[model samples]
Target: MLDWMNRYRRNRMVDHYITQLGPALRKRYGLREQYTVPQIQKTLVAIHLNTHYLAYAVALYRHEASRNTVNLRLSQTFLDSLRAEMAKRYFHGRDSYRAHDVLGLVKTSRWRGGRSADGVRSWVAGAAD
Candidate 1:
């Protein structure tokens, strides 16, 4: 029961982070419907390389712009590229690592410094409308 609760909380946290991070990335990188599959894949690769975290990469991939614009084949290709980027940045020559391991290593605290959560929430809310 306790373990389940912890897992639930973690999932929620991941969801919240994804919701906030996805749109910000889209706006920053100018990922729009006009971008081709290869172009979208490259942008995703860039995001993973910059963040060094799979959760953020996944979030960015699942963003509305990406879903509406990027096709499955290209999305899979982007995932492969993201995995390679993760291996390069975080694996440090290690042979194996899980997605959770990469996600666990990401410091959410860094987000609190430059932009307040309230500000992000408002920005995201505004964008939604």
Candidate 2:
């Protein structure tokens, strides 16, 4: 598995992050009820693209798997590291880039706060902004 990670990391760290993250993301965030299949697919594609960029940043900084430690807990420190890296990459230099695509994934997630399907849709759509 580490070998595969190394191979993927060769091209772009984002690719490595996506390869590790895509399936987990699909399982964790893909919604069956928020929208139709086509809509969900579209959302998934957008989310995947966005996440890939984040993965790339994380990889570029040698932060692959840094978010979760051997203790098996997700660490805010890891996320802060990634976020700081992203900010530096996206905002500092003229040639830098931001993960706007990944940021867009915020709109595609399903919210379970509603009492009914319609309510959920309203809540989600409302919260999207």
Each candidate structure's count of clashing pairs? 0, 2
Per-residue CA lDDT of candidate 2, range 19-93, in tens? 433333445555221222233234446555443343333322222233223233325465456556545544463
Candidate 1: tens digits of C-alpha lDDT, residues 66-91: 45334453364555554455466556
Cα miss at 32, model 2 (Å)? 13
User: In model 1, which regions exceed 4 Å deviation?
Assistant: 32-53, 56-129
The Cα error of candidate 1 at residue 99, in Å, is 18
Model 2 bad stretches (over 4 Å): 1-11, 16-24, 31-74, 90-129
Q: After superposition, how far is residue 114 of candidate 1 from its true place, in Å?
A: 35
- Model 1 lDDT-worst window of ten: 56-65
* lDDT score for residue 37 of model 2: 26
Best by lDDT: 1
Candidates' lDDT values, in order? 0.47, 0.41
TM-score of every model? 0.28, 0.27
Predicted candidate 2: what Cα RMSD to the true structure? Answer: 14.9
